[model samples]
Target: MTSERASPRRRDTWIVLAAALLARLAVVAWAASRFPPTADGTFYHRIAERVAAGLGYTWLWPDGVVTYAAHYPVGYPALLGGAYAIFGAHPGVAMTLNALLGALAAVAVHRLAARAAPPGAALAAGLLAALHPGLVAYTPALMSEGVTASLVACAAWAAAWVRDAVPLGARRTIAARTALLGVVVGLATLVRPQSLVFAPLFALLALAPLAGPRARRATLGFAALATACALAVCAPWTIRNCERMNRCALVSVNGGWNLLIGADPASTGAWSPIKVPDACREVWDEAGKDACFGRAATLYITEHPGAWLSLVPRKLAATFDYCGAAGWYLHESNGAACGDRCKLGLGVVETVYERGVLGLALLGLARASAESRARRIATRAVVGVGLVFLFLVHAWVAYAALVVAALFGGRTLLRGPVLPAAAVTVLGATLLTHAVFFGAGRYGLVTFPLLAGMAGLVLAGFRTRA
Candidate 1:
């Protein structure tokens, strides 16, 4: 780790990246042949097509219903729109771009590992991300996951530098690092608003590593500057939403509607579509419906707190099932609805991916923590084992108890080890957010880079004690 004895850094990095890209391209080719882009992507493609044609982001129906777009984020479509503009609405081109993004994401993961631990670990992390099965398969899809993953990885790498290195660097250096973090995170947020959550959370956690007399001021300064830049980056979208929609929409209107989706009376907290009540549709526009749905969700949760709590375990189950049944790893082919067998097969794939690949990342992170004495992962280990046991026994209460204990017991660890804390916080936030609203397998994809970096640390091992 001190210096790679066997190979040069750039050579290793490119090797990892090239291999990852090749694998992704191969997977993209196979998937493109076997599966078509699903509905989730169909809308993105339609909007991109509309935009490419100079029609603006608008949708029209036969019933004289004219709607302006406010449902999804603009960034991914904007990327697709650019591709369409150049190549003219080709799915192959889009998939190729997605694969390219996934490869770049692998590079980001490599840098993240190198920053957090030793340089030797970087290639391992990159390789883990490159070969990650779900990551490879998702590369061919029209979903935002590929773009969001790449951005999040780059942001995470920048954030690691800000949190782990900036406090010790020069004054201007700190500012530059913080601003860069902001720029990357802001871009990621445009792709998926969930990226915004990391700014505040990581800022708060950044306070952990600053230890000098000036640590407090430095922490506050870093947080304030980073957050300011992020908010500034999002200003254009916020202003556009407000001016156009006649409402102050900081991001897409999907949050409230998503909240409502999870708060349904019959909701199990998994991603299931329910028919909107006529009352919900009384308001014509998505903005109005989102507001109405938010209120309805709030009312439902208030009136049925017990029901909400009951769904927590199910949601948590789905969220952390790793590759089990929920979270962001759910693989649907061609956006077509799957029968029970395919759903079950996807669950098995996720389980395999989570246990095998994610477990590698977890192990790598633990090793990194151990090598750097970053922060202990004893509590994290317990939680991992608990989840595995839960998978076997299907005893939600047992795993819930373990998770709660880990949350309380792990604070000391979280306070010291920045990457582990970041990783755990990401997993916790993703799981809790989805459980509170609704979850799909892809929701868990956001944490992939962090895990890969940790896995890299493990591979780096004890600095080959001279």
Candidate 2:
């Protein structure tokens, strides 16, 4: 009798897994059909192909056209290049790898949610994550966002599990698990340096449940080990950048440009040359300007105090504005050529117009409620750590805010006494930072799985109450 029941349960589990896998594959196929090769896709894919074809990493193409001069990190191209070499240089193969990574990310989300909530809520979270439109849009592209996001999700899951292990008095096991989390985080940083922001936040979140001298010492020791491990993995790339360019830059030369673009007085999708005073522009344009862009932006802000002050609120609004549009707007010498047919149409525009008011209100209320719950010292510490890293690195305040709101909603759903408050606090910190900087739809993707899990918890509660 027991064996028969267990066999049926096992079969049901397999069926569910198969269904989830199929759902993700179907989304990947649909995305592959909809969007052709984007400009970024063309650049990354071509470079990967070149790398696979035995072209040295630093060689410039003819007529001053450069292919691999550090526009992005080497990890993603290297991964895609290896894929191309093994499976023939096909876009489909590269996209398939991304789809697989995204699907694995869903699994990781399921594991994390399951640890916190019931099995039903966990399944719902996984399904919602699989169906999220933003994830759907980006997973098949050759861009690093989908893969990087997946890595981060995995790292977060590993970190959370490590935390769970540590509290259960498993010191050696926790140390091993935490080290693994560090390795995952290191790889994530290699794919996109921005993920380094999560390192300190993870440390704080991990240490929250521990107390006493022994726990503190263990926490510190484990954190140091993890940091050393991450640094060891990252050291090679850092050394390569320094040797190749004679500049000791750890990551890409895009942070300043990103900050300038995010804070600039341009429309949603626009790009412009970095403009400082003549002397400052020259100084800031040098390879060493990666460290100077912040100073230059600060100087710009100081000089145009009123204009800079006004940009804060404007940037906040821009971050949340869902025009449902796509891509950067480029200008031709002759006239403004609105390239690409992905522009918002009547239906998309109307949807945005209708939903804007309600979405904003719900978002605000959710954020406020989360903040109120996060008033404790521990929660404050988490928010502080995340915010400091966010301000120093990127400036997508609106995206941050939306994540916080969604987290608040998630916490509200779970009814767990502790995590909801912390989740909401992190969300608030994300929003406040986003408001001061900029936002993007892709940046908000990280929080959706958590939010979806939270939403599932909420719906379950409603059903139970009804």
Candidate 3:
């Protein structure tokens, strides 16, 4: 009976995966002609070309000065360089790679949802992920969000498997899953070092329970092992930074600069140019500049606590206000070539899709907490009203509701299923991380799959109960 139930769902999952790949490939095909790698994409492409040519990760100034650079995390460019080496530095190669990563993320979401929900819900989560507007739109941008987001989903799935393995008491299986979790997180950290924050959080939230001392011990052991493995994977990058950049940076050299950007009074809580403080003007080395910026930002925060705190809401707003990554990238890269109608249509689609998903996710979390039919119906009515208001009346009210809902849902899910709990924690962590540094619509793309999975789980629960 179990096999009978699983067979159809398995096949459907494959079909969903194929649809996701095809959809992304279609965008890639269009992007090949329309999107010509602009801004950050240009930076990644040039660096990748140099890397493919066997010139280490160095930046070439227009004046012809080549300097050793580590401003951005090396993982994405390095991955692109490896592909460029084999495929001759074509933009299509990067797009195709993103499609594959995006598809993997969908499957990872399926596995994650399956941990707590029925197989049908798991497939729904996978389907949602495969077709997520933001994920599909980001494929042509040559950005790290694709790789980082997919890695996040994969890491979450691996962590869920580790949680499942702990109850089985098979030491080898547990050890292997923990090791795999570490490796996935380690790679994720390479792409986006903030990923290190997720490793232990996922461990405690997913594995630790109020059950017994034995479970607590397993959680601690798992956290320690996964953290150690992730650090081990990053050891080489750290060593290279120490040797090449004269600084033992763990992952990247932009941390201090980013911090200062958010802390500066002139900041609008988004990406702004870093103004070198008086103390850091003389610093020439990347590591030294980063450290100097760090101190300056700390001083600013210490001196102006109120002002720095005020930026938190603004930062979050910048991160989640709207979603049009594909359109944004296309316009940035091709400008008028994207056409006004194309731009307007993409904007509307991105906004409606993002808002709908967010509303559904909020509803799912509410469903997870609803214990009685009365409460469930009330929750649904409130959510329905909120969505209607969000579309027709006011957005701020809806967004405020989402913030409150997330806080409440996160508290409730701490004792719920490991998969959903971990997913919520990731969402919380993303918000917190962006609040500290800076925020961008693209930065939150990493959470799309997790959000879809959570929504799928609750919707599935609703169906089962009905």
Candidate 4:
């Protein structure tokens, strides 16, 4: 019948999309049943309930007592609240939404990888992302990681589109894509303020190919648009905070404090167990006696600069150690923790066993020798993000682990058309950073998608070679 002929590309995309959706649904169901509620989940869940009950952006205790002391951003809770409005405050519904977003993220990754590599590579990347254990675990939780990851992936995809579409002599398409990129980045910032780090980088990267007089103007315009969108989304909470607390903070006020805690000798090291007053005072000069716990950490860092310098390696190690294991890194033992004691069980052991020693060794070597173009680009981005966190936040093992994972994971994913050099560098970075710092399992989740993508690429290459 000469009815309708679907293009091969369209058909392939639809098939991949359908498959991704099914896989995500399965992950959502598994996550819903397999994992118990986590600490952050409880916090976000309760916050969402409060939001649903018209508490607005104000944090409150279960007893209806107002508490602005909580350090979390409002994006995830607000999303959960919207879900609660429709689904009646059920955690499962909220999780289902996360699962959906995660699936969307897989789709985005697939498109990006496919454009950069090949269709098969894209499909493999999408499948890996959908089935990623780390992502699966967080998909149904009340936490923001899954949603944030999705947002990041979406932003990356948007950036890729802007980059590719502009060069193909599509000016109109470029403008629209750039606008969408701005919107996506803005949305990502709302979810996690840290995403601001990538906004400028992406803008600069996107403008690289644009010619002469138009490039600068386009870049500036896009940057301004992105900033405006971000401010629009975040300004309400900032205004509310200013009116209520006289603090004109656009984001949360916990960055300095987190940095102080992460860099403090007393806290980052052995003194982590002890609750010392004035922990944050040195870095934040305005800190008072009651705020001494926060100042004290800063004071230690300032007074013992040499000691702190020496401790950097250790801090890096600790950041990558078991301590970075997402919610499991918490010291307290609970059903929600991200450690072996938590509901998820020992994920580190599981990863190690699943990956195997030989595979791990090969990955390690690959990461060490990642000197190629793709590896450099991905590593630079990872390093830039890591540096931002290191300077602005606290240098933790988890952060180190995150950087390594990104670097290695990106290399691994790209290794099919390329060699294993990038992967090796990423692994080396992760191990060295972890060895010198600290780590936790959850902290490693950020790179899980990359790892899965890399594994798929490696497998595909082996099959091809064989």
By lDDT, the better pick of 1 and 2 is: 1
Can you write out model 1's per-residue Cα lDDT over 38-124, one digit (the tens) per residue?
657878888888878887667767797757767898888878888899987877878888888888888877765554554566677
Give the winner by lDDT.
3
Clashing pairs in 3: none
List, residue by residue over 203-301, the lDDT tens digit for candidate 3.
Answer: 666565435887677777877888888999999989988998988899989899999999978788789888989999999998889989999999999
**Model 1 residue 387 distance off true place after TM-score fit, in angstroms:** 5.9
Pitting candidate 1 against candidate 3, the one with the higher lDDT is: 3
Candidate 1 has an lDDT of: 0.66
The parts of candidate 1 lying over 4 Å away from their true place are 1-7, 63-66, 118-120, 163-168, 204-207, 275-279, 322-350, 358-381, 384-419, 459-466
Clashes of 1: 16
Global lDDT of each model? 0.66, 0.54, 0.78, 0.54
TM values, all candidates: 0.84, 0.73, 0.91, 0.70
Off by more than 4 A, model 4: 1-24, 27-36, 61-64, 67-70, 168-173, 211-225, 268-299, 318-350, 353-440, 454-466
By the TM-score metric, which is better: model 2 or model 4? 2
lDDT of 4 by residue, 74-97 (tens): 788888898898788876688688
